[model samples]
Target: MLMVTLLSIACCCGCPAYFGKPMWEQYPATASLPAQVADLSLRTDARSENTIRELRTDVQNAHLLADDTFAGVYATRQGKTATVFGTTGFHLTPESDAEDELTRLTSKYDLGEQQVVETDVRGEHQRCAVGRSDGVDVVVCTWADHGSLASGVFTRLSLADSATLLGTLRKHIVSRD
Candidate 1:
């Protein structure tokens, strides 16, 4: 019994060391892009009552901005009357200053009531803010991890819902390899 217990403990502790860093840590592409569109969890359901009507991926445009960037937009509909748009992007900039970017966005959009929050995203830090732009409610979430930056802008959803959705979407941008 003693030998068996010791062996189990050794194996448990050795596994992680043998595996090295996670895939996200080792590759910028994996860490910066979502594995799939469905991973964003932006779909209609009985509870959400929101059906995705259109999905667009702009890989070429994203590549124009940066060699390692992924961008997408989703348009969702509610019944026949309401439509909402959400956009997400992962940009890899070796010298990105997350704070400066946040400041620029806040200034351009006139964001209000900004709050710094902890995020599951593998980043140095995350910031979230809510505001109104052109008579529409908007939520912006930004985070920087190493040289990669991730951000999401959500509209037509409640502030609380926007935050929740942004968080869920950010969590899905993981290393698939």
Candidate 2:
């Protein structure tokens, strides 16, 4: 299944996420692109070399501008595998952009019977969905705003957990560029 393949591709690094601060605690929100994304610069191993290469290629081939910033992070945390790719650019229609991103994932992976998860993050428009691929549960989420758009594929995490993690990661990700 496409989702499984992506999960494997994303399970490249095994570093833990920084959960010291409360995931729900709201910090100041900025409407600018990110200078760096957490978990994206982890060290890699032989098992992850091909995966990293493929993910980088895919992100480069994505519909981002020549000067826009991009990153595809493969990380495993608390036994869950997440492969996320995000790009920074200007887009006013976050709602439509979020939907279009979900549509892209729906077509990219065989996610049957997708269920939408409502995610409300300040200063960002986000859409999340839960589905199954190859009998393995997968949660796909995307968030977009005036400055950035990003998507991720997660496995073995509950819908709520998935949404929360992405929301938490956004705090460390989006910053003035």
Candidate 3:
């Protein structure tokens, strides 16, 4: 639901970027789940794999940016599993760009009644919500900087735990080059 037309305008007219960052830059991002993240192991089962595949297609079809990269992971620890799907793309409005993705994620999972979480992302804008998924209490967190957007589904975990884990995961999964 976003476009990259302003980059051309800025380049043509020599417009200054926000906080010295150019709108045309792609942020050079990469996402992955390591073998362990705060005790969560990377999931590679058929169901997890299929879910990630379908979700990645959704991200691609969203047409969020002119140039985008998508990544997803399902990790399990102590019998609790979570899925995180994310993309890195350039958008004129980084602050609210991820909100659409968050809404799409919650609706896709049939979530109801979300509570916003106040987690910070390097002083960038982030929105998080907690809800029930498949009768399991869970939290979904979304974060966006000038470069990237992501949301996660944490099953059988409290909001605090999900937020903390998501923060940690974002640190590892998303990075600038």
User: Which candidate number maximizes TM-score?
Assistant: 3
List the candidate 2 regions with Cα displacement exceeding 4 Å. Answer: 1-43, 74-78, 112-123, 133-135
Q: lDDT winner among the candidates?
A: 3
For model 1 the local lDDT of residue 150 reads 56
Per-residue lDDT over 1-177 for candidate 1, one digit per residue giving the tens place of the 0 to 100 score: 999999898898877655434323624444343434432423344433422222113323322443344444444443211222222234334124455455656864578766766654443455667765667667766655443455566776655565566555555653433
User: Which tens-of-lDDT digit does each residue in 42-141 have in candidate 2?
Assistant: 3256655665577556656776452354444455544566666666666656678777877777866665544454655444677778776567788888
Model 3 scores worst on lDDT over the 10 consecutive residues at 17-26
Model 1: how large is the Cα RMSD against the reference? 9.4
Q: What overall lDDT goes with each candidate model?
A: 0.48, 0.61, 0.68
Ranking by lDDT: 3, 2, 1
Question: Model 1: runs farther than 4 Å from truth?
Answer: 1-27, 31-67, 79-96, 120-124, 174-177
Count of clashes, each model? 0, 0, 0
Compared with the true structure, the alpha-carbon lDDT of candidate 3 equals 0.68
| Order of models, best TM-score first | 3, 2, 1
C-alpha root-mean-square deviation, candidate 3: 7.8
